[model samples]
Target: MYDTLKDTYQLFEEIGRGRFGTILRAFCPVSAESVAVKIIDKSLLTDETDRACLEKEPKIMTLLSPHPNILKIHNVFETEDSMAMVLELCEPETLYDKIAHRPLPEPEAAGLMKQLLGAIAHCHRMGVVHRDLKPENVLFDSRNNLKLADFGSAEWSGEGGSMEGVVGTPYYVAPEVLMGRLYNEKVDVWSAGVMLYIMLGGIPPFYGETATEIFEAVLRGNLRFPPKVFRGVSPAAKDLLRKMMCRDVSRRLSAEQALRHPWILSGGEANPMD
Candidate 1:
């Protein structure tokens, strides 16, 4: 099976590795283009539920295909030994890399958030929820535009527009999720809020020495912005953050609502110095 794929694509150069498998930057001779191949070992699929989840990924990708901010899958191939998914090649760095040291300016952060919201909004529009929406899962292109990747944890909204389960990274999980409450696409909204906070403050709104402490803070969701840190930030930017991080599910802004926020509408362009 690997040989068959080799006939079409020249797989080389390891780019990323994870528990199940590794990602390699490969080239297609026929298309004369470069692509990323996520090869997962079939042996890891021994668990019935695990195999089901992996199978669901291709379906979810098809549901949101061609969206500007969602990563695109060119093809999927399952072989006797492994599963290969061919995806568009995004630039190497991610949001996690860009703001690793300090937060970006309000205007800059808004610009990026707008793109992020747009992507998630598209997914929600299609009734899909990206269970894991963290900076590490978001990749940027050469142009710095954001692309939401890794639908591995994604699931359909299902009946009633909500889902049940405890999934997602600790820091970004919605408070409701932490409470073991039912959730929907709005969970992604919470993640975007956490991301917005990190972008502007250079740290997550809820943080603790351990994952449990972090979970406790998220459940509390009693977050605040220190004036000294946000001193020069614009009012509209702060307002949007407040709206986004609202703990109440009903009060929290949806992806579409977030996009319409004044700060986002302004393109996050008003420099703080003004």
Candidate 2:
């Protein structure tokens, strides 16, 4: 399958690889455009459910069209043996990779966070809940604008269908989600809070050697503020984090509320130097 289309797209080199597939930087000769093509192994489509989910992606991407902060899907096709998706190629790196290098300055963090929240707010308004909202899934365009990617875990909420599957990166999963309790858009807010924490402190509030330990830590709701590392984290920022990361999903801040938080909307911009 890939062998035939291989000639159509000039594959340069491997950009990323994951459990599902490999992404390559490629050029569409006919359109003279560059795109990141993700090639999924046919063998991975072992069951009917997997195939259904894989087929659903193109539909979901079509539904999310024209969003400024979301990666755009140009096309999807399948050969006799493989499936491929053409997507917008984002440059530089992911927010996760960036934070791993250094803590983002407060004003810069707030600006990026604002764009992320706006993107999620747009998703919620469209009745879509991006169940996975971790730093790794947030990509940065050339101008450093945030573009939410990897919608494999996203679920449409308007049709009255609710998500029951255990999804999302373990570090960012909300307590309610871990507890197996029914949840809503608030789950994304909790994940966003975790992202905010990483931006300020350059690490997650909870960490452990193993996945189980991390889950246990999250269940305990033990959030520590490393003031030494996050010297300039303001009171408003801390207050906002507390509200968004609340254990009880019912008390978690909504996207709109978080956007309007004093820290985000304050007359003065955040200053990391403070």
Candidate 3:
């Protein structure tokens, strides 16, 4: 653990600001490589629980680093005042940026979803639940490969078990979570489903001006693909989305199961619904 960031890496311009820290583009002389360093100020974490969660972020990334779709952490440094994580550098554009311009074509959306599901499956198999899954958490690398970033809300599920917590963003959170019920890794599938919807429709399935309204819309579980937005989407693609966003947790498809869906397996070549 270095006492400060400047002692080890050459920090550059701030590339991004996160919930508790700023991400800087950094260069490591020893490796002769560039990386993104997330530097968190310990003083900002006044709540003990928040600090504990922050401490776990890098550990979770380390535990799940083997998967190509997951962001890789190169090093972790900590001091009394700061926690810095050196991570694999990627393209600055996030999935959120891409979708904001317009919805992706079916083939492109399918390709991205496959990679996202693969990452989620790997996390689930490791007994880890990424409670927070959103477009902002998805990054693109230099080669345009999708990478799952940000594990601040992740939790270990204890050997294929379930966990209870009302954690997750309002737009993509599973209905079970809002109900304060014990939930499993399938919650990620729900969030991924929301991403899929946005990729194809350019808007989330649930809508509200406020968090409470969004939560209510989620609990209502009224899933529909507006013809104006979904006209060109394949039937198989819509089928997969329905299964993933299914309100009944028992019926929702797991990430592994979603990988096998016809739309994904066929790479979005499935016939579109007329």
Most TM-score-accurate candidate: 3
TM-score, each model? 0.95, 0.90, 0.96
lDDT (Cα, tens digit) per residue for candidate 2, span 58-160: 7777788778888889878787677888888898588888889787776777777788888888878878888989988999777777899887778777555
lDDT of 3 by residue, 1-274 (tens): 4545677789999999977889999998888999999989888998977887898889899999878999999988888888899999999899999999899998899999999999999999888899999999999899999999999889999754789879989899999999998889999999999999999999899999999999999999999999999998878888999999998888999999999988898888755442
Runs off by more than 4 Å, candidate 1: 271-274
- Of 1 and 2, the candidate ranking higher by TM-score: 1
- Backbone clash total for model 3 is 0
> What's the lDDT for candidate 3?
0.91
Mark the regions of model 2 whose C-alpha exceeds 4 Å error after superposition. 1-8, 46-49, 158-161, 267-274
Cα deviation at 161, candidate 3, in Å, is: 1.4
| Backbone clash count, each prediction separately | 0, 0, 0
Against the reference, the lDDT scores of all candidates come to 0.86, 0.81, 0.91
- The deviation in Å at residue 151 for candidate 3 is 0.2
Residue range 158-198, candidate 1, lDDT tens digits: 88989888989999998888788888889998889889888
> Clashing pairs in model 3?
none
